[model samples]
Target: MGWFSNAPTANRIQNTNTIAACVALLEANGQVLNEVNTFASNQINRGQQLSAQAFSVQGAGSQLGRELQAAIGSLGALKTNTSQQLDELGQLCHNMELLIQQFDVPRGARTINASGRDIARVAVHDTSLVLANLLVLEQNSRPDIVRSVQTIDRADTVLNQGNANQAGLNLPGMNFRFQ
Candidate 1:
């Protein structure tokens, strides 16, 4: 039922599969970080625009302008720290993937790795887009939440296919390093 459930050869193949999963995880995390950055930038821009409007209409010395300025200042401080933390996380995930790739992998355990990753990557892309769009829906702007839901459904389908593949779908002509 599992890669490590068999023997040493299976262990090696499992390690290779683990590395593939690590790559997907790292890629997903990177996309998330990029979305965070976009969110922060859009938020800062919105705050600035709001502040400008308040100042122009209420006068630069007005109480509304003063309050908006303070809020924007706080957001600025938070963005600096938030972006730095996200960068560190991205670097750590990248390094982890690299480390995992250094391990040797036995043949015949590699099955549809790229296909699985493609499925996961589509899900990740849609997820980030949904999050970012939700954050900045804008004036009377609407995003189709259903699309994200459908992507999640596709991910579920991919998961089921992966389970079936792992269960007993061994290829006949290939040499399996692990029995």
Candidate 2:
């Protein structure tokens, strides 16, 4: 005969389900974090491009020149926001990972009581919330960057027009173009 009753089996099943759910949540969070990181990198690259263009047209005091400056400023703002959001996401991920590790600790017996079940339930809930928040942050940050980039492009277009008109006057282009 088995040393324990069917209660142990039930507890084992519950524990298994809890662990599975937590692992799934963690994996989803990981994917979102990766996407956020990729988006942040692209934002940085775009910011750098805007900065370089601004520097190229630094001396020319025209509407297009001012537009270029504004574009650079917007990009700087986006970078700052993205960096802050990423830091928060990283911290959340770290905390979730630690919680999962704690759940994975070996138990003395298979008879999971109410306390163990409660802990597992709480961990699962926390992980889900973290994942949700991460997704929301990523979605919000993306659109902000997109809007900023669009503005920058519009400014660049106006600046390019100025560059074309000033071709004969030897005014600097928005960027250094070796002709």
Candidate 3:
């Protein structure tokens, strides 16, 4: 009968320990989520920069392509290389988004202890905020990649057309031999 009296105390101690462990886990998860988000965002920024460079090259090639058709061939190859890299970057962003989704942030909305619950809430809130920012970065950067691909494709088309047109013309300085 005396041992039975200590049962409630033991259960309370166990519950408190469980809550503390949960709080620690949530805090650690929040930190990891932040690190992952930062990495993903940085990769996205780099992808955007690469996309811009591709655009610049495409612009210059487009302007110069009218005069020197041979330059278009080399510039078009460069454009292809950059566009492929952008596609890989986009895939990486997608994988990062999926990885972030797998992290199960604990919800403490119904916990009875106000202070522990508040800590859990803040951790969960912070992780969610970081996730949102990552999602925004991903969404925004994806469009740039798409647009870059489209532009590069258009440039390729123009370059091909120019090459075809040049094939039939016999410019004074350039010799045309078709096999």
Higher-ranked by lDDT: 1 or 3: 1
**Candidate 1 local distance difference test against the native:** 0.42
lDDT string, candidate 3, 1-179, tens digits: 21222233454445445444444443444343344334334334433443444456667554433323333333344344434434444444453343333221222322232333343344345444444543444444444434433444444445455532221122111111111
Q: lDDT per prediction?
A: 0.42, 0.51, 0.38
Candidate 3 weakest lDDT stretch, 10 residues: 170-179
lDDT for 7 (candidate 2): 46
Q: Report the poorest 10 consecutive residues by lDDT, candidate 1.
A: 170-179
**Candidate 3: where are CA atoms >4 Å away?**
1-8, 60-179
* TM-score-sorted candidate list, best first: 2, 1, 3
Candidate 2, residues 1-179, lDDT tens digits: the string is: 12233344666568657756766655555554555445445544654565466557665454544554555565556456545655655665676565545445444433333344665776667666655655555555555555555655565455465542211122111121111
Q: In terms of TM-score, how similar is model 1 to the real structure? A: 0.46
Kindly list the per-residue Cα lDDT of model 1 for residues 34-95, writing each as its tens digit. Answer: 55445445545654555566667667685655554555555455456446645654665565
What value does the lDDT take at residue 144 in candidate 1?
21
Query: Against the true structure, what is each candidate's TM-score?
Result: 0.46, 0.55, 0.32
Ranking by lDDT: 2, 1, 3
